[model samples]
Target chain A: MLTTLKQHIEQLVPLTDAEFAQIASFFTEKKFKKHQFLIQEGEAAPYEFFVVKGLVKAYHTDTDGKTHILQFGQEQWWITDYQAFYSGATATLAIDCIEDTHVLCITRANRELLCANQRKMEQFYLKKSSFGYMALQRRILSLLTTNAKERYEQLLLQYPGLINRVPKTLIAAYLGLSRETLSRLS
Target chain B: MLTTLKQHIEQLVPLTDAEFAQIASFFTEKKFKKHQFLIQEGEAAPYEFFVVKGLVKAYHTDTDGKTHILQFGQEQWWITDYQAFYSGATATLAIDCIEDTHVLCITRANRELLCANQRKMEQFYLKKSSFGYMALQRRILSLLTTNAKERYEQLLLQYPGLINRVPKTLIAAYLGLSRETLSRLS
Candidate 1:
């Protein structure tokens, strides 16, 4: 599991074994069963998690009780309520397991410590955050520009395995399409 | 103008006078007239810009010549075709001056060199990128969940100075609302 974290880091920056060991020291491993909640709205979200196995989702529930899917965390993905984690504010989003899950967790302090001590880790995060930012920008473009069929196709292309794994209703929410519209597109 | 960049950086990290000088040396200042293009679709966009004066808009135009506003960068904001800037791909978006604009531009190489030589710059960027990621996440949520009027209100709240400056047609495009619809709400 630690190897997964190490490999994820090494994808952007090669690390010496000692450096990897130091980087590994900041993280703790945790597991959850399918359908378990990892974060809850209005609670503190103190850590960012890197998935080692299984699936989880982050979402926001509206005052009207509608749930909107924000993202899915599968193997090798990172998930967190970033606003709350960084601001030390209550979570506005909740994360729940879609399948029994394992993740490596790091607090903002430990993560910053890793960055301060291991420049490679800081570089890794900068790259990750930049890529994540670009992905969301593309998502915004899609939301503004694309039709339901185009969005469905883009989602499938971006996450080839997601359609088979994520519930159809959730996929509809992510695309901002009605279930009937999504059914027609798919 | 470089002082603006220094002030923006200092908002996140304190810098020695010499450190600020070294950081400032990596950037070149550029000026654009209103309606001038900074980045054009299908062309190399090799610089990330920090706006010191005036406003710019980044957008994508579809096959049928419909424009969708991706962002408005005013004073103290950064704007670029990030996809192309990082990946060395031709830009898929275009950015243009909304008013006569003055900006500080940094190429990725110089940006990385600065980060390598100045750890604080890396810290500044990590914080900035994380904030950008969270802002985009909130945008995706608004696009998914909010009605036109709610989105309009949220946009006003987020960028309090925007409504008076940006053209109504562009604001409507940014909100994915028809001009007639936006007129009704406003």
Candidate 2:
């Protein structure tokens, strides 16, 4: 688990062993069964999870009784209700496992504490935030200009080779299309 | 000028007088005429600008010779090429003033310096970042689900009374629709 975190951090910015340790200090190893909720709506997001093993999805139901898949987290990916985790608000998103999973969980308080006490940790957080910002920017652009076929292709690119790992219906929801439309395209 | 910054900060987290002064200390005021590029693509983005007066648009031109307007900043709003600013990469986005403008600028180095030296400043950064995160998330969802008309309406709702302040072509680009389509809808 620690090895996984180290690898992920290195991809963003290289850190010494001591610096990596300071970041690892905030994370605790956690296990979840398939179909378990790591987080649920209306509760503060206690921790953001880094997947060590297994698949997970983050989603929320809209007012019209529809479920929208916001993100899917596989190995080396992180997932969280960022608003709830950062602002002490109730989550609008819920996280659930697709398979039995191992994760590294870091709570809001611990994450902030690490940022305060360690310069390298602050740098890591900065990098992570910036990358997230960029992804959001790209996703917004895609949402504006791309068609369903283009979106599906992009999603496949983002999660490469994982299309068969999950249901088509969920993928349809994530693409903001009807299941019939996805079937036709598929 | 300071009053606008104060009001903007207050909308996030209310600052005491001293706290406001500390926040203000990081900013340097500057003026620009219409069509001035605040920062251009392929140049490193060194600072974030807060608009005290006038209008500016941030955009990126893709390989197809099409522009994507990421956002626009007017009074009480902030703008930057966040990816380039945080990562020190050459900017993928560019900014230009639509009219005469005054801005308060803070470089990447000074932002880090301010956060390191002041707890209040760190909190302020955190609050602003969280808001940015939420806005990005909403943009992602909007991209997935909204039609052109619906998306335009949402943008109108977000900017409120600022729609008339900028050009229709840019607004159409921001909405991910052709100008003719936007014109037809309008």
User: Per-residue lDDT for B85-143 in model 2, tens only?
Assistant: 87899998899998899999999899888877765666666657667877888777776
**Docking verdict class for candidate 1:** high
The per-residue C-alpha lDDT of model 2 at residue A51 equals 95
TM-score of each candidate structure, all chains considered together: 0.99, 0.80
Native contacts kept, each candidate:
1.00, 0.37
Best by DockQ: 1
Worst 10 residues of 1 chain B by lDDT: B2-11
lDDT of 1 by residue, B1-186 (tens): 988888899999999999999989999999999999999999999999999999999999998899999999999999999999999999999999989999999999999999999989999999999999999999999999999999999999988998999989999999999999999999
lDDT of 1: 0.94
lDDT of 1 by residue, A1-186 (tens): 998988888889999999999989999999999999889999999999999999999999999999999998899999999999999999999999989999999998898888888888889999999999999999999999998999999999998898999889989988888999998878
Error of 1 at B114 (Å): 0.9
TM-score of B-chain for each predicted structure, in order: 0.99, 0.94
